[model samples]
Target chain A: MNRKLLLAPAAGLLLCCFGCQDTVNTVENEPQEPVSNIRDVRVVTDKFLRDRLIIRSVRMATAASGNQVAEVAATNARTGVFSQAWSGITGENPYTVAYKFVWMDEAGMAVETNLSAWRTVQIKPGETVFFKSVAPNARCRDFLLNLKESD
Target chain B: MKFRLLLLPAAALAALLSSCATDSHYVDATDTTVAVKNKNRMSSSDWVVITQDAGNALLASPLFEEYLEAYRIDAEAALKEAEAAGEKITTREKLTAMKPLLMLSTIQNNTSEHIDSKLLTERLREILFNSGKVRFTTYAAGEGQSIDAATAQARQLKNDPNIKKRTALKKGTVHAYDLSLAGVIIKQTAQDGRNNEMSYTFNLTLTDNSTGEGVWTYSKEIKRQHKQGALSW
Candidate 1:
């Protein structure tokens, strides 16, 4: 009787523990994805920042009048990483980076322009790299820089 | 004695079944686990900024500093007027006063083109409301209080002739607030350039607090031409 009693309860307990389960949606190689990204970035501010981006020329034209652009200088590529860290965020876990550029005129009006390449980059841990982007369109005179945290 | 021995096992089995324990079985949705998440990626593509040597060279000029300083002041002032009412003040308040209300995530449209209006709008809305400046409202009263054709005859003696007057909030009627902001990403570039260089323009605007006019506007332009021997990103 004693043996039977112990076996029955023990068996039940094992079944309960073994049956408990939960699910989570996850994948591997997500590291290749950036930790953070910025969109709608408008201008480039710092001179030190100018060195980090790879710029390329695109086939685009402009309107007869200089105020508006009829075509754009499409960005052929962008950086996988750009910039420093802040807010106790560093390295691979909460990686921080950003990029930006500005638009200006020959007379420097800072006119409203349809601009910016929506690009994102992912940097591996312990890797130092620069960022790049092409002008969003023709008639872009100035650029701004944006550095943001990466996931 | 034999029966008693068997009773022990039976009692143990019963005890195990009745124990405060749980097991999985094919059951209704209520029995399933539910997950809650912020939906923002912890790691995403980093935002990059690129500049040209000429863009950098101009920064040494005094004008860039002056321009940036002015915009910094404007940004601080407007932000203060809206949020300064609630904060602990100290020395260097202007530089360190504003508090972060919304934890922003870079809204991305991983799809090829820039079709991120939905994400952008939602993020902006989150920023506005998260600041404690606005709250959500369903305004269910519109459906319940409006008089349909069935009740149209009951309003014949209404004193107010203006349609807007009827819906006008009474003096003491509690009303919720409405908040919104307009932000556009404007872009422009050079008319002539063929040296494998990149140039861009950014035109940002801040509107008036009261009249909704473009109170303050600023532009920063940067260009980078990669010289054969020069450093470029």
Candidate 2:
């Protein structure tokens, strides 16, 4: 009887862990020509966070006003729920993240502007979210994106 | 002795609670640490998001690019007309005069909470001005009058030796606003059992003052829900 009781709880726990994992499925048309202006960069800090928030690619294009525009595609790589045992409350994978963009001039110096602000975006497991920003003026030729977990 | 022992424990508990009290800390206004607390009222974080979103939308719109182009065209035409009329208007003057002036009309706050919509308007004005595409005229009539009177006074004193070195002030040179911006913020609330949800909708419109027609319009909605006792303030 003791063995059966132990097995029952063990099986229930296993089921909970496996069944709670969430993932997304996607379908797209045939691959088109790759964009030439897309840059490849390194991500070096916070391996756990870097894994959860995966940066897929960064692309740049010219806007109508002759200013540079950038788009970042990031995916949520988390797979399961992060639950609090005491409160019996569950949170979905890929928690809310806040992001901001800084514009840079031709000399790679940051362009100072007050219009930029941190914006919040939520992503689901395995889902990709695109963040787009435009340079503050024609002087800006490059950009940087900063991301952090929302408190 | 038993009563005294019980009191001792109670006093110790109170001391512990006092020691555990939270201390004040500073957080950046743009940081995510600021979150919505009251469902019925707008928070500073909400203001940041709304202003950012509005600025982004306005900047990305084709209308904004067209507006800048139209200013250049208007300046060139004005210079040509002045030259034809035998008035001496320099290219530098025309270049400096191409900034399109915009006026803040009204922001209707239809919510129960007392919100200073001027904050949003000011943020918008800052963004538009920083973009180098537009300028803002004072919303106060009294302020406008004062500025006009000051400009006239400065023009009268232009020939004074003390003021001769200063830039010449001119009357009737103030660009009248070609565009006006107005908006309304509406709050709606709904309750379902222990869950209360609040939605705030901000609707903004940019209109051509001469034509009295809207050139660009945008609406942003922010929704927050609170389950009673789920969060501690």
Candidate 3:
């Protein structure tokens, strides 16, 4: 009876650990529609973050006011929920990401403005989210987006 | 064999000590990679985010686009007509005259927090002013004036005899505002079991002073939540 009791608790612990790995299933159109994705150069310093957060595409548009707007589609590919939860130095979950858009003028000089501030978004495992922003002014023709793991 | 064992523990101790040593340094205030310290209240980072969101939205709105387009077309037409009529009015004057005058108005705060509304308005004013699409009037009649309380006092100096006649400002020079900007901040709170959530919404509108109609409106909401310990639940 004592052995059975110990086995029961051990089995329960095993089940909890194994079953806590959360993931999602997704479906989309078989033939994906054409998107105006731009060719972007990337510098990946954090391999772990880049591996877990996959960037799908980057698109650009010009508004009527002559300001440039950028949209980046990214997904969280983390398959282990319990193992990754509260793993950040600040106890932040890996699912939350902070990003900012730095704008530049035609001369490649950084255009300083209040619009270039850090913003954050939450993406569940296997879910995709788009980060969008308009340039600070019409003079801002180019942009560089910075991303980091955030709480 | 004994020496190898001692080296293993010494290396491990060094590694452990290195891991525990944290360097305190100054980082860029605008850097996005800075670790967040608190999420429950409005911090400097929150202000930065809010300023960016609201400023971008207002500057990119369709109404502001139309407003600029109308001014451009009108200024060009006026310049062409003046040139044909052999008038001496410069293009710069036409552009300046056509630029719409806006006055800052009251921003009602309905939130429980003692939030400084200037954090939003000042940043917005800087962005809009730098755009060069609109102008702000220092004084408005009947309605509230801009944040500069010195406009009226400066004008009152015109009556002072001690002031030079050439440097003194003329009467009837104060231009009335063509538009006014106003806003409101609202807060909502909820609790479920051990979880607490707070939401704040900022709503702003630009009203045409002549027609008394809101020409542009925008709103943004920020939500934050914190869950207590598992035992609390």
Candidate 4:
């Protein structure tokens, strides 16, 4: 009787783990044209947000007026190894992240632009969002994107 | 009995002091994560967020590219003429002279609450002006509470005998604006038994003064919600 009681709770816990831990699965056709990606250096201060969102890629381009622009794609997936069945479940809480972009001049000093305001966005457990920014002027040659978990 | 009586008064004094405790501190002006005391009203941080988004969008628009192209052509032609005449002119001077002038117009507020439209317009003006891409003239447009009356008053000094003729402003020297910016703010509210929600929409347009056509337009929406507890209204 005791053995059966122990197995009952064990099976219950396993089912809860499998049902509650939901993940996202995505698919799309491969790109037809070539694309360029910029290598990025990151400084992580918030491990909680870092665990929830993954930076997929960073793309850079120049506008017609000589301003630099950047686009970042990030997915809300925790770092882990899970079974394929995790993707089929749908019972996870969404996470809200606040991020900002600070532009730097060619002299490597931070540019004083009003564009560097923290903006918040909510992402579901398995969704992706893109953050984009344009340099205040052509003199801005580099940028840093800061992200933190929203209160 | 004496010791117990003294303890009772000390404890009472502690309780009274604790009840009157106050909390006040400074926060970074740029920090946007601060909690909203009232969800219905927009906070200063909301103004910051909206201003940056809308201002950046306008700067990145294709119309701004056209504006800069025009300035480039003008600057180049002016430089060639100066060279032909054996005159010297700096790049900064040429840019300032050739850059387009923009005027701020009225931003109508269509919300239940009394919102100062300057919260939006002034911030937008500051960002666009500091970008080094455009300049603003004291010459105002339709219904935008103008600060230009001071300039006009100063010009009237030309008539005053005390003012030197050369020190007073010239009558025909005022530059007309090349572009104007105008916008509107609207809000929607909802309540479902316990939670109160509000959504604000901001729309802005940049119009070419010479062509009388909108060169760029942008719209942004922000939503906020608050839940009432058992003791709250």
Using DockQ as the measure, which candidate wins? 4
Which ranges in model 2 have alpha carbons more than 4 Å from their true place? A1-22, A80-94, B1-26, B35-37, B90-92, B139-171, B230-233
lDDT of 1 by residue, A69-106 (tens): 21112221222222222212334322334433344545
Off by over 4 Å in 1: A1-151, B1-115, B118-121, B133-179, B189-210, B214-233
Tens-place lDDT digits, model 3, residues B1-233: 99999999999999999999999888666544464636456656666766788887877788778866775677578778977999877555665767777777778888767777767776787888877667876665222223566766876787899987788766766667777778888888888988888777889888877778787898888777888788863
RMSD, every candidate, angstroms: 25.3, 5.8, 6.7, 4.8
Model 3 spans with C-alpha error above 4 angstroms: A1-36, A80-94, B1-41, B71-93, B140-146, B228-233
Residue range B118-208, candidate 4, lDDT tens digits: 7777777777777776788876665644566776787899889999999998676566787788888899899998988988899998887
Single out the weakest 10-residue window by summed lDDT for candidate 4 chain B: B29-38
Fraction of native Cα contacts reproduced by each candidate: 0.00, 0.37, 0.57, 0.52
Error of 1 at A68 (Å): 40
Query: Best by TM-score, which number?
Result: 4
Rank candidates, DockQ, best first. 4, 2, 3, 1
- Of the two candidates 1 and 2, the one with more favorable lDDT, higher being better, is 2
DockQ, 0 to 1 scale, candidate 3: 0.43
Can you tell me which runs of candidate 4 are displaced by over 4 Å? A1-24, A31-36, A79-92, B1-21, B35-37, B67-95
Candidate lDDT (C-alpha), each: 0.34, 0.74, 0.75, 0.77
Candidate 2 lDDT, tens digit per residue, A1-151? 9999999998898688667665676676755766325765665666766877888778888777777778888887775544312112435344678888889888999876655677778787777888888777777887888887765
